[model samples]
Target: MANPTFWVAVALFIFIGLLYYYGVPGNVGKQLDSRGKRIADELAEAKRLREDAEKLLKEFEAKRAAAEREAAEIVSNAKEEAERLASEAQEKMADFVKRRTASAEAKIAQAEAQASAEVRAAAVDAAIKASESVLRQEITGNAASSLVSQGLNDVRAKLQ
Candidate 1:
């Protein structure tokens, strides 16, 4: 009872007894359990949010793939339409060229026929003039008149 070690041991026992009487250890244990439950709830919420985000990502990916397919289909249809238009244009050009060629040939044939008619008319006039000059130089009086009239009748019959 007079020793310092004995006094220190007695003081430590009193402090432990006071802590138990005040319910300090039980309060600490309850606070630790509440903190653990809060942490578990937060982990569960995080897991649920992650699953929701994954589902949204999958939906967006499916939408993007559908959009790409639709775009490709539109491009393919446009290419087909363009090719069809180009072929139609070529066909129209070919038809136009054929019609123009036919028209040009018709005009050329008409001009050739007109030129041949003019040449024949000029030759007939030249022949008539030559025959008139020769007959006037060779013939004379009433006998010559009769002969000229007979020759003119023969030339007219041959021409017809």
Candidate 2:
């Protein structure tokens, strides 16, 4: 009954009972409930932010895919256009070559005709000169004397 430990325990019991009678425990329970609700709200907000970030990433991915598709189409169209232009150029070049060949052939034919005409005229002149030279060689001294005597007899008859 005289121990100091016994007195301290009795004082602690009195303090605990007074605290319960005044509804202090109920106040502590209310504070704890409010703290738990705040923590739950913060966790829910964090989940919502994470979901928004995932949606944004998906949207960016879709945009990137569309851009890649568009680029492929443009490249395909460019290649097709280049091929068409090359084909058109080839046809035009072939036509130009054909026209040039025909023109050259026509020129060669005309030149050949002109050269043949010139050769034929030169052959005719050479033949005429050869015939004149042959005739001079055949008429000799006897043919010259007979022409002179015939002319003198004709003059004497006219005088008689």
Candidate 3:
């Protein structure tokens, strides 16, 4: 009210003088340097931690890849073993079938030979009966005597 401009100027001068006396370039530079160093250290620590994390990730990836490859190899080996077993089983079955067929064929041939021998024996018996009947009807005494003598000689030769 009385001289407002004068009081205003005095207050401005006091404020500036305090800044000059106590502020290191106004002390702000020293304060900011300390804070900046703290911030830089924090950034470096964060960078180190990030690098460690990246290395761990790479190791895990490599391990995972190796495990997958091992699993694939195991599967391949199992498949091959199964196939080999199947092939061996098939071969054994084929051999068994062949042996069975041969045995059946041999049995059939033996049966045929036995049947043929029986048939020959039956025919010979029938022929002997017929011959005996004819001889009984036609033989006279002298002729029968001559036949009997020849039969005795043949029997003796067969015995020798």
* Cα TM-score per model: 0.66, 0.56, 0.61
Choose 1 or 2, whichever is better by TM-score. 1
Worst 10 residues of 1 by lDDT: 120-129
From the highest TM-score down, the ranking of the candidates is: 1, 3, 2
Residue 93 CA error for candidate 2 (Å)? 2.3
Best by TM-score: 1
Q: What TM-score does candidate 2 get on C-alpha atoms?
A: 0.56
Task: Please identify model 2 stretches exceeding 4 Å from their true place.
Answer: 1-35, 124-160
Better of 2 and 3 by TM-score: 3
95 Cα displacement, candidate 1 (Å)? 1.8
- lDDT by residue (9-110, candidate 1, tens digit) is 999999989999999889989999998999999999999999999999999999999999999999999999999999999999999999999999999998
The residue ranges of model 1 lying beyond 4 angstroms of the native Cα positions read 1-23, 124-160
Could you give candidate 3's per-residue lDDT for residues 6-89 as a string of tens digits?
A: 888888888888788776464688778988999999999999999999999999999999999999999999999999999999
Supply the global lDDT for candidate 3. Answer: 0.81
Q: Candidate 2 lDDT, tens digit per residue, 108-160?
A: 99888888767765654454446445544655577745654464455434532
Question: How high is the lDDT of residue 97 in model 1?
Answer: 99
Ranking by lDDT: 1, 3, 2
lDDT score, residue 6, model 1?
Answer: 96
- Give the lDDT of residue 148 in candidate 2: 42
RMSD of 1: 4.9
